[model samples]
Target chain A: MPSIECREIYFSYRRSDPVLKGVSLSASPGEMLGIVGPNGAGKSTLIRIMAGLLKPQNGSVLLEGLMLHGLASDDRARRIAYVPQDYHLVFPFTVMDVVLSGRYAHGALKIFETREDRVIAGRVLKWTGLENLADRKFEDLSGGERQRAVLAAALAQEPELMLLDEPTSSLDVNHADNLMALLDRLCSDQGLTVIMAVHDLSLASAWCNRLGFLDQGRMNALGEPARVLSFDRLKSVYGDSVKRLDLDGRIVIAPRGKRNTNA
Target chain B: MLDMDKTRRKLVLACILGGLWLLACGLSGLLIGSTSIDIVRALNGSGPDAQILLVARLPRVLLAALTGGALASAGVGFQALLRNPLATPFTLGVSSGASLGAASAILLGLDTALLGSAAVPLFALAGAGLAVAVVYMLARRRGSLLSTNTLLLAGVCLAFFFGAVMLFLHYLADFGNSYRMIRWLMGSLDITDIMVPLKVFVLTIIGFILLYSNSRRLNVMSAGEEVAQSRGIDVDKVQRRIYFSGSLLTASVVAATGPIGFVGLVVPHVVRMFTGPDHRVLLPASFFAGAGFLILCDLLARVLIAPTEIPVGVITAILGGPFLVWLLRRQVEN
Candidate 1:
C-alpha cells in the first residue's frame, strides 16, 4: 500500500489568501517524513488536510492507492491516526478511557469496548510506558505523560499511517527527544508511516528520514537533512543569525553564538 | 484492563438501576397524589377514584417522567457537544423560541379559540424548529456547521432575541392573559390529554436511542476535533446529529411542558459525579436520575404547601441550583 499521498494540494480559509499552494508529496510505511517550517508556513494546515480533518480546496489526497475523498471516514480512521499538538478534554476521563477511544473504528456499531479492545488498549498503554498511570485522570498527568498518553491513544488505532501536527511544540527538550525517538522506533519496528509538521529544524533533521522545508505557503526544499538545510537555504528562509554545523556525519542547525552586541 | 472493566460494570449497573428508578417514579406518579385515589377502586374502574386517577394524575405523571428523561438526555448531549459542563438543553435558544411562540399565541387569543389547548403546543413546536434553523444558518460557515464557539454564540444571541420578543408580547397582553403567559413560561406538566404523554414517549425513545448510539463518537470528540477525525469520526456529521437530536428532544418536551428548567441542566452533572462522564453510562444514569428527581419535585409541588401547589419548574430550580453548588464544592474539596 502507498499510505497517504497528497497531489498538488491547495487550501485557503474562508476565501482568504491561500494557506497552502499546489503542494504534492507521498509518504510510505517505514518512513518518517518531517515538514519543517516557520510560523504561518501552513505545516499544520497540510497535516490537518492529510489527516482528513480539512478538505483541500483543490487537487486530491489518496490513501493506499484509493482516493481519500471516496473512502468513508470510519474506514480511513482504521488505517490512519493523527496526533495533534494538544488534547484538551473537559471531562475527567482516565488514561485508559482516552486510549480506548482510539479503538472506535474497530467495531463501528459496538458501544462498549470488547475484550479485544481492552486488551489492545492495555498493550498500547504499556508500550507507551503508561501502564501505572492508566487509572489516573488524564488531566492529572504531567505534560510529558499526557503527550505519551495521546500517542498511546493513537497507537491503539493500530494505524498504518500516523500524522502529527506540531507534536512536540510545548514539550521540553528531554521529552521532545523521547517522543521523537518513540516515533522513529515505531516506524522501523511496526512499519508505520509517520508524517509530522515540526517547528524545530535540528530536531526534525535528527529523527526524520526525509525533510521538507516549507516556507510562505510553498515547499522550498525536500530531501535528506544535509541537502535540505544547506547554508544558503538556511540563511534565506530563516534570515541571518543562524549556523549549520556538521559533526560526526550528523547535521545540527543552531543559532549563531556570541554575536556582536547589535549585529 | 481494570479501568475498562470498571466502566463496563458501571454501564450495566446504571442501566439496571436507572430502569428500576424510572419505573418506581412512574408508579409513584400514578399512585400518590394531592387527592389520594383508592387504588383498588381505580384499577377496578368502578368509582370516582378511577376518574380522578386516570383523567388528572396519570397523564400529568407520565408527561413528567418522559419530559424529565428527555430533557436530561438532551442536557448530556449538549454538554458533550459544547464540551462544557454548564450547558443546558435551553443553552441553544430552543426553549426561548418555544416560550415566544406560547406567549404570542396567548396574545393572539388562541387560548380561547376552537381546540384552543392544542394551539399553543403546535405553535411552540414550529417556533422551536424555526429558531434552530436560524441558529444553524448563522453558525454554519460555508457548508460545514458549528465552529462550537459560533454555534454557542449564535444560540445565546437567538435566545436573547426571542426572549425580548416574548417579553414584548407579554407586555401587550391583558393582565389575566399575561398571567397565563408567564405560567406557561414557567413550565408545567398539567396536560389532561393522554395522547401528549404517548407522543412524548415515542419521541423520547427515538431521540435517546439515536443519541445513545453515538456515545463512542462523543468520547472521541472529547479529545478535540483533530483527534476525533483521525479516529474516523466525521465531526460535522456528528455535530449536526447531536444538535438536531437534542434540539428536537428539548423542543418536544418544551412544547408539552412549558420549558421545565434545571432538570436538563443539573441532572447530568449529578450523574456525571457517579459515572465519571462516560456517555455510555452518564446518559442512562442521568435519564433515570432526572426522571426520579422531577417526579419527587412534582410530588412536592403538589404537597409541599398543599392546596396551593407550586409550579414544578419552581421546585426544580430551587432544588437544582443549590444541589449543583453542593456538587461543585464536593468535587473541589475531593
Candidate 2:
C-alpha cells in the first residue's frame, strides 16, 4: 500500500463554497509526488488536510493503513512532518532553537531536548547546509535560507512522510533548484515519501516522479509527468493561451505571444 | 561548550542578583513603612515594634511579592498565547473588572467584619471571572477559540464598559466614600491579616507551577497556531488552558491589591530581553524579577512622601514607563 493516501477527500471553509472537492491521491515510500495548480486551486488546503492540520468534512486520509484523524496529534506528527509557506518570528530565537523545536513531538512531555535530540537536529542542519547559521537569529536569515531552515526543522521530526506547501514560492532560481535537488536526494537515500505543491511546472516535471494537476478544487489529471504535463492538458486547464516546449529533457510551459498566436 | 557555559553563567548570575535584590527590598519595605520601627525590637518578637511588624508590615510585603510575581507570570502567559508583546492582565479587562467590583463594594458600604476581610477580593474575583467568560463567549467561532483579534476587541470593549460603570458609581457616592474608593482604585499594598497573603501565596504558587509545566508547549505556540499544530500541539487546548489560568492568576492578584499596573506589562518584556524567549526560563525569571520589582516599587511608594504614602501603582508606572521606552529603543538599535 502507498505510505500516504487520501480517498475522495472533500472540505470547505464555509458552508456555501468548497475549497476541495473529492480529491484523491496517494504516494508510495521513496517517491516524490508534485501537485501543480493555479492560484485558489486548493493546493494549500489539500496539503493541510494531508498533514492532519485540517479535517476533511467527507472522506479520509490514511497513513500506513491507519486513519490519519484517528492517530493522536503527536503520533501523526511522528509519521508526517509539514513545512508551511511562511514563518513569522516574533522573538529572537536562534536557528538552532527553531530547529530543535521539531523534536518536540519525540521528547517526553514537560522535558527539554536531550543529547540525542541535539545530535539529530545538528545532522539535519548540516544536511540542509544551515550548520554555519545555527547560532544566528532566525529573524535575521534571508528568505531562501529561512525556507531551508524550516525544511531542516521538518527533517528533524524523523517523519516517514514530509508535506510541503509551496516550499519554493519565495526562493530564487538557484536556491529553488538546490532545494529541489536536496529533496530528491533525501527521497532516494532515506526512503522518504515527499508530497509538495509547486508553482513551477518545469521544476515539478523535472523532479517529481508523478504529477497531479488540480483545477478548481478537482483533480484534472494525475499520472507520469509527461502524461500530466501534455500541451493539450496544459492549454485546457490553464487556458487556450498556454503553450509548452520540450527542452533539455524538461517540459516548459509559457504563455503564447501575439506573433505566435497569429501564426 | 563555551557558549553553553556562558549561558549557564548568565542564568546563575541573574538568579543570585535577583534573589539578593528581593531580600533587600523586602527588608526595606518592612523597616520603612508610615511609622519607623526598631529593627532589633521587632526581630526579638516583643514591644510595639513586634506588634506592627508581625501584624501589619510583614504580611503587606509578602503580599506585594506574591501579587507581583503572579501578575508577571500571567503577563508572560498572555503575551505568548496571544502572540502579542503588549498583552497583559489589563489588556484582557480582568483588572478593570476587579477595579469595578472593589469600587462597588466600597460605595455600597459592605461590612468587612460580617463578610470577613476577603469580601472585597471575593467580589473582585467574581467580576474578573465574569469578564473572562464574556470575552471567551464573544471570541469563540464555531466552538473553537482560535481568533486572537476577536478576543482582543471583546476584552477592550469590556474594559471600557467596566470603566464607565466605575465612574458612575463614583459620581453617586458621598465625598468621604468617593475619596476612599479613588484611593483603592489607585492600587495599594495594604494587608491587615497574614492569612490573606498566605492564601494568595499558596494559590499563586499552584498557578505558577501549572503555567511552568506548559512552558515548552508555549514556546512552540509563539511561532504561530498553525505551526504549533504541525508540531503536534493542540492549539485550542493550550489556548484555553493558558487563558483560564492566566485570567485566574490575574484575578487572584487584582482581587487582593487593586489592579497594580505596569509590573505585569513591563516585567515580562524585561525578562524576555535576558532569557531570549524560551518560556521554561522566561516564566520563572519573570516571576523572580517581578517579585523584586514590585517590592522595590512598594518601598519607593512608602518613602517618596514619608508619612503620606503614594500609591504603589503610580510609582510602578512612573518608574517602569521610561525604562520600557529605553528597553524598546535599545532593542530597535540592536
Candidate 3:
C-alpha cells in the first residue's frame, strides 16, 4: 500500500476562495516525489494538508489504509515528518536545542530529553553535517545552515515519510545540490519516501522519481519528469514566453528573451 | 559528552546561586520591615516581634513570592505562545480587566466584610475570565487559534477598552474611594490573612507544571506554528492549554496582589539570558529567580522610606524600565 494517499482534497482559506481543489496524490516507499508549481499554486497548502497541519474542507488523507486525521498527532508524527519552507526564529535557541525538539513525541510526558534522544539528535546533526555548528545559536546561522538545521530537526524524528516545502529555497547552489543528493541517498538506502515541493525543475527532474505539476490549485500533470516537463506543458503553465533546452539529457527552462518594447 | 557535562554543570551552578540568593532575600524580607524588629528576638518567638514576624511579614513575603513566580511563569508561556518577546501576562488585558473589576467594586461602595475580604478578588477574577473569553472568541479563525497577530491585536484592543472603563469608574468615585482605588492600582503586598496566598500558591504550582510539561512543545513552537505541528504537536490543544493556564495564573495573582507590574514582563527575559531559550530550564528558573526578585523588590519598597511604604509596583517599574530599554537597544544593535 502507498505510505500516504491523499484523495480528492479540497481546501479554501475562506468561503469564497479556494486554495486547493480536489487534489489527489500518493507516495510509496523508496520513492522521491517532487511537486513543482508556479507561485501561489497551492504547493505549500497541499503539503500542509498531507502533513495534517491544515484540515481540508473535503476529502481525506490516509496512511496505510488508516485515516491520517484520525490518528493521534504523535502517532502521525512518528510516521511522517514535514519541513517548512521558511522559519523565523524570534528567540536564541541553540541548534542542538532545535534538533532535540524533534524527539519530543518520543520523550516522556514531562518533556525532558533522554540520553537516547540526545544520541539520535547528535547522529542526525552529523548526518546533516551540522555537528560542528550544534552549539551555535539558530539565529546566528547563515540561511543555508539554518535550512540544514531545520532539516536535521525533521530527520531526528526518524520518520518513514518526509515532506519538505522548498527545502532548497535558502541554500546556495552547492548546498542545494548537496541537500538533494543527500535526500536522494536517504530515500534509496533507507527505503524512505520523500515528497518535496520544489521550484527548481532541473533539480526535481534529476532527483525525483515522479513529478507533479500544480496550477490554479489543481494537478496539471503527473508522471515521470521527462513526460511532465514537456515544452508544451511548460508553455501552458508558465506562459509561451518561456524557452526549454536539453543539455546533457536534462531539461532547462528560462525566460525567452528580454522585451524590446522600448525600442 | 564533554559539552553535555559542561552544560549540566552550568545549570547546577545557576540553581545553587539562585537558591542561595532566594534564601538571603527571604531572610532579609523577614528581618527588615517597618518596625525594625531584632532578628534574634523574632526568631526566638518572643513578645510582639514574634507576632509581627509570623503574622504579618511571613504572609506578605510568601504572597509576594507566589505572585512573582506565577507572573513570571505566565510571562514565559505568553511570550512563547504569542511568538513575541514583548508579550507578558498583562499583554492579554487580564490585569486591566481585574483592575476595572476592583475599581468598580470600590467605587460602588461594595462591603469588604460581605464576602470575608474576597469580594474584590472574586469580582476581579470574573472580569479577567470574561476579558480572556472575549479575546479568545475574537481571535479564533476557522476553528483554530492559528493567528498570533490577531490574538495580539484583540488583546491590545480589549486592554484599551477595559482601561477606558476603569478611568470612567475612577471619574465617578468620591475622593476617598478614588484614593483607595489608586492605592490598589499601585499594587501592595499588605495582607493579614494567609489563605489567599496559600490558595494561589497551589494554583501557581499547577500552572507551572502545566507549562513545564509543554516546555519541549514550546521550544518547537518558538520556531513557528507550522514547525511545531510538523513535529507531532497538537498545536491548537497546546496553545489552548498554555493560554488558559497562563491567563488563569495572571488572573489569580492580580486578584490577590492588584496587578504587580514588570515581574511578568522582565523576569522571563532576565531568566532567558542565563538559561538560553530552552523552556524546560527557562520556566523553572524563571519561577525561582522571579520569586527572589520580587521578594527583594518588596523589601526595597518596605525599607526605602521605612514607615511609609512605596508601592512594590512602582519599585519594579523603576528597576525594570531602564533595564528594558538597554535590552531593547542591545537587541536592535545585534
Each model's C-alpha lDDT? Answer: 0.88, 0.87, 0.86
How well is each residue in B216-272 modelled by candidate 2, as lDDT tens digits? Answer: 898888789888888988778878888888887888888888888999899999988
TM-score of each: 0.94, 0.95, 0.94
Q: Which residues of candidate 1, in runs, are more than 4 Å off?
A: A257-263, B1-5, B27-31, B36-45, B48-50, B113-116
| Each candidate's DockQ | 0.71, 0.59, 0.66
Q: Which stretches of candidate 2 lie over 4 Å from their true place?
A: A255-263, B1-14, B33-36, B111-116
CAPRI docking class of candidate 3: medium
Candidate 3 local lDDT, A1-263, one digit each (tens): 99889899899986667988899999899899999989999999999888888889999999889999998888888888999988887899889988887887775264566778788999999989999999999999998898889889888999998999999988877999999998988999998899999998888888899999999899988889999999888888888766788889887776677662222
What pairs collide in candidate 2? none
Q: What lDDT score is found at residue A47 in candidate 3?
A: 92
Question: Docking category for candidate 1?
Answer: medium
User: lDDT per residue, candidate 3, B37-61, as tens digits?
Assistant: 8777878976898889988899999
**With candidate 3 superimposed using the best TM-score fit, by how many Å does residue B14's alpha carbon deviate from the native?**
3.9
- What TM-score does chain B alone reach in each candidate, compared with the true chain B? 0.95, 0.92, 0.93
Specify the highest-lDDT model's number: 1
**Residue-wise lDDT of candidate 2 within A1-263, one digit each (tens)?**
89999999999997659988899999999999999988999999999999998899999999999999998888888889999999987778888888988988997384467768788988999999999999999999999999999999899999999999999999998999999999999999999999999999988998999999998999988989999998777877778777788888778877788988899
> Candidate 3 at residue A180, lDDT?
94
Query: Which candidate, 1 or 3, would have the higher lDDT against the true structure?
Result: 1
Candidate 1, TM-score vs. the true structure? Answer: 0.94
